[model samples]
Target chain A: MVSTSILPLQLDNVSFEVRGVRLIKDMSLSFPAGPRTAIIGPNGAGKSLFLRLCHGLLKPTSGVISWATTEDLNPSDAQAMVFQRPVMLRRSVAANIDYALKLRRIERSERIHRIDQVLGRAGLHRLKSQPARTLSFGEQQKLALARAWALKPQILFLDEPTASLDPAATHAVEEIIDAIHAEGAHIILTTHDLGQARRLSDEVIFLHRGRMLERTPSPEFFTQPRNDLAQAFVRGELLWWNLGKDNRKNKLKQSN
Target chain B: MNEFSKAVAVAFQLVLGLDHQLIEIVSLSLQISVLAVIIAAFIGLPLGAAIALFRFPGRMAIVVFFNAFMGLPPVVVGLITYLLLSRSGTLGTLGLLFTPTAMIIAQVILVTPIIAALTRQLIEDLWIEYEDQLRSLGAGPGRAITALLWDGRFSLTTAILAGFGRASAEVGAVMIVGGNIDHVTRVMTTAIALEVSKGDLALALGLGIVLLTLSVSVNGAAFLINETARRRQS
Candidate 1:
């Protein structure tokens, strides 16, 4: 633990456009380090895109994002993200963790020690040698978390990490996440689960239609949302449910 | 009256009795094809991975060229190689025109694109599915390719085996470049050609059996690997 508690992230007029369709618009915000920050949005709200930009996976079309940390910080070394649907190399569960540590040039004994701890944390110690692709859906997500957790990233980005898990598995994953936060790793996760956001998030960054609607504390965001969209979203009457899968219906109804 | 019986007896004799010429030809064919496939895989895997993952000028052009080359005529490749290594040509100083080395080179050139193009398609699809996850895990471009390749190893093995099957059965290329020289470049395909030309049906039939059996076994092995990989992925 480097104890760089004062490190915060700044996004200044950030924007990302693909094929002239803006994924994330000109948004400016600062994120204080530590505690879990949840990004909540309806589908297509660019919640995932925002998390990606934060992790430097997608370069901004305009503006800058900087980490205000003392001394030099390698952006590559400072963060890790887990996707909505996890993927693993066609190796054993243990090897996935080992690969991450090896890339960072961690030694064998130390790597093994950390792997044990992470696997145990994720409740995956019993399946260490199992082929990664053979694991159940929830198990794979847990393994993805274990692999990232082993890195001990300064800021962890998660894109709906528990979306597909069963209740028991989801509970187990939440415990691992809580443990990670306890160990002092800052987290920025995107989720559609309002209850999950309320339970785990210290602060909420609410996005709607690629725009940052609010950046309020979780309790305040839920109780007294500043935007109509946020309030409608919290009441579960957002356009997403009305939209459904048929674009024609969605467009016709929303237009009216 | 017993034509089928005779065929069976000949096949049996070819396998049971260690026919010296047949053994030598099979060994040489295996040696050349295995070497060629190994060399091609080493060159092709990374090339294919790069083509799938990277952005560069003319990438689509390069991809199109490789896809076109996958169906390249073995005889044409042999002809070009033969000309290049001939005594009067620029690379003729080494005088390797009718050698096994020339045959290996021909096989490598013929199959490198096959492996690369097939691997590129496989990795391209895998990248779409897993690229975000890879980037999120702190994987650099190199590590991401390594992970994709590792995940797609089963498909890659099948590609390599397909290359081996092509190399082992290719007569036109090896025949032209190796010149079917005895005790040297006389691999199975070229040996079969020579035996048939000489009306030695027994030796040619025997070599045919070996080549057929090898292809079948190689395909069977590839099937097993593919099935296992599919099951794991599911």
Candidate 2:
């Protein structure tokens, strides 16, 4: 079977607003196949909202988001997503993987084969029958990745996949991510971890205050970001959040 | 106080002996209520899930309608069913009135709103949690409903049991529809009601005890299932 890619997706003047507050300002962006891209931004910078818009979980309030696809294409078969806090079905690991495959209407034998293959690849075959929610947080994230892989999507979107993970868990998740990228899927993810951004992405999109300020190659963006906010972010000089800490300390002293 | 002790003593003896009439009443009670609940679940679960997962015109109104009807007076429902099944009424020719089938029908009406209303509230909350993930997985509204119900099975079991409790405890509906016919349509609640009026305090007390045991045992089983599922983190 020949697979046609739905890449080179274009968004023109795309803006998303929640109750009159524009979370994603007028943005024109194109996502071409091949490169592993990462969206880097600070807290409240709208990275997750941007990801949701692209993943079609939220519709843009204005402007256009279009996919350049072949005549007969199934959007579901072409893309998948893994949320930051993994959502494990109230079922076994094997069954969770099977459910995604079943939604794509994969045949039973093939679904079983894929379930076994993905579970073994994640080194979770031993706990395949165990309820997924019973697994540790890291294991659940891995199962989320494994389940998405079983779908064999051409594009995978991740929203802060390792944000809450410990170092070891984050490492495991990053490894699975690399494995997915190696299998020829387009990887688009968001993270505030600058080191992880540098390691995983070929291109970096720096966003600040709900606006895309810079798009540059990994090496150049890290060395000398063009925008002032992006530059300050790279230098770790945006530490104004310490005011809250100082205020709390002063309150404690006054109480004493 | 002495009279009360004598009543309790006679009740226990009758229970241990399993009087023929008592057995028949208890068995019929279980049969009607269990069957009614089964039918109610089959309709209520998917209906409730649909209301939770989909949005349409007047959806909130329908939700409010179900919630309000959950407290629907059993006596009113019995009177309505009595009318529909009575001769010259809508379903009159079926001759179902005064039969066990009529009682089952009335109980189904009484139990369905309870099950549906509770399932809707439970599933609506779960949908908020699973919506984004399921949508990303390409599940449409239809599939989402089934997935939510399956995942919420342990909690939904409690809702089903609540309906069963209501069905088994209420007397007005079955008494009206079943006519409390001696052996043919008599159930524990209806029999107890009849026995009390006839001054057979011992039998009424006995059936009351049996009914309480059934309610507690069923609810306890549901609680254990939920507790186990919670520990297993499902």
What DockQ would candidate 1 receive versus the native complex? 0.54
What is the C-alpha lDDT profile of model 2 across B1-234, one tens digit per residue? 987789889999999998888899999999999999999999889888888888999999999999998998989999999999999889999999999999999999999988999999999999889999999998878988888999999889988998999999999999998999998999999888988999888999999999999999999988997898877856
What docking class should model 1 receive? medium
The pairs that clash in candidate 2 are none
Model 1 share of native interface contacts: 0.69
| Residue B195 of model 2, lDDT score | 89
Compute the interface RMSD for candidate 1.
Answer: 2.1
| Predicted complexes: DockQ each | 0.54, 0.67
In terms of DockQ, the best-performing candidate is 2
Per-model lDDT: 0.85, 0.89
TM-score of each model, in listed order: 0.91, 0.95
Per-prediction fnat values?
Answer: 0.69, 0.80
